[model samples]
Target: MADYLDFVGDPGRDDVEGWLYPTDAHLMSVVNDLQVDRGFRGDVLEIGAYKGKSAILLGFFPEAGESLTVCDIFDSGAPVSDGNARENTAFYPGLLQTDFEKNYLRFHDRLPRVHVGPSEELGEIVAPGSCRLVHIDGGHTYEVARADMETARRALGPAGIVVVDDWSSAHIPGVAMALWERYLTGELIPLAFTKGKFYATWDPAGLTAGEVADAVATRPGIEASGTVRLGRYAAAGVTMTPGDWQRYNAGLRAVYSKLYADGGASAPQRVGF
Candidate 1:
């Protein structure tokens, strides 16, 4: 199967629009690819499909029998809170459902199941224990984010992965608060965390934290910086900002060039993600 990077091209050269970082993109692909390789088949869900940058990547990894679903309140005035409404206005000004659909169709022949409303509706729309991966990136308020986290728990199967965006952003302390509350008392087991997202699981029966960290280590440009202690437990920590990504790309180019020069046409140009 073709990887998302194959469709999008070199991250440093062919750039796509939206907020998805290159490091995050690589990690997302690795998570899904690992599940697919292990013969695990299930639905995929994204709580926030902001212009389909990440959604397009999610769409690429679902196998034939699997499905993908995305939910967002695009231009609908459907946000449940004033803070969430303000977030939409400030961060997603003039956004429309068509904006996401247009960008999505550029890469995928069809769009995933789209639910245009608050992320709260996802628990009712998406069946419980059905999804393998649930990306919770909707509202940033503590109320909305906590609701989304609960929705993710209900929507995931055993060992299913849950990724929460802006889990610890300084400005979005609510998300961090909600995240820690769940991590401390809830069943969401921590797997890993990057700069912008936190990865966890509903159950370790299907996938362990160690396994996730191992998979992340295999992804390009991501450096494992030991673990983050959560009480008695610990979660893997990874680091790679935009500057690090640029340096990683430069290093890759240098290696590829050296390989070609040393082995002529026999050296591989590039491998799929």
Candidate 2:
């Protein structure tokens, strides 16, 4: 197995080459435990992959028979809503499939099945009920978010998870609205929340969010009880501020990089909890 720690300590850093948020570590733990530890079997899906940051991590958990499907606009010039266009222009001006493939190849030998167009084309591409984990981060508008959630639900298998990005961000209230509306209507059961993602599932038996948070709390410097109850479900929060976590992660990345550069073995090394 590839050393996950070597590739994922800080994906936004120069060496890692992507735009992953720091809370991704917690998300990784959730995905790892569900697919790797619990032996869930199915393909992986992600609606938005800017440069394969989170996609790289998701790629690591797919079992032998599973595939990872990544859907992104990727210089397709597809027409989007005005708001989405503005946001994409401002944030992902240089988004390209080649860059995504290059970065993904650093950690994975084969590139995921790439769908280059609007996420609306997902139904025609990915089979229904075939995904173990589906990540929705494509568009922040209410229409797009809701449509993506619907697609994710249709694509998820039993015990499958749907992780939505920017769910609670003040700048992206549409995502929160879409997710809460689904949760209220019983289409989704809230599992957990990271700094930038909301994890949900259709099955009540998949209540592993609290366990994920508890495991993260056990990390060296993180405070306990990062898990919070949300009505019938659970949500996890980061104890440290985003800035603090970035700084700490940068330090850890530097240490690991140096250790690996010295021809040292890549064993799992625990840092702050």
Maximum-TM-score candidate? 1
Instruction: Please report, in order, the local distance difference test score of every candidate based on alpha carbons.
Output: 0.77, 0.74
* Predicted structure 1: clash tally: 0
lDDT of 1 by residue, 220-271 (tens): 5666678878876688777663466566567557656765786674433232
lDDT of 2 by residue, 1-273 (tens): 235543444433335444454455445554556556666778899999888777888887787898999999988898888988998988778778898899889878999899999999999989998988898889988989999999999999878898888887798799999989998985577766656677778966654666666666665433333567777766766554555566767777776777688688663323432
lDDT of 2 at 37: 67
> How many Å off is the CA of 193 in candidate 1?
0.8
Q: Candidate 2: list runs displaced more than 4 Å.
A: 10-18, 214-224, 238-273
Would you list the clashing residue pairs of candidate 2?
A: 219-273, 220-272, 220-273, 221-272, 221-273, 222-273
- 213 in model 1: Cα distance from truth in Å? 2.3
* Superposition error at 56 for model 1 (Å): 0.8
* Residue runs of model 1 more than 4 Å from their true location after superposition: 1-3, 6-15, 241-244, 248-273
What is candidate 1's CA lDDT for residue 66? 83
- lDDT assessment of candidate 2: 0.74
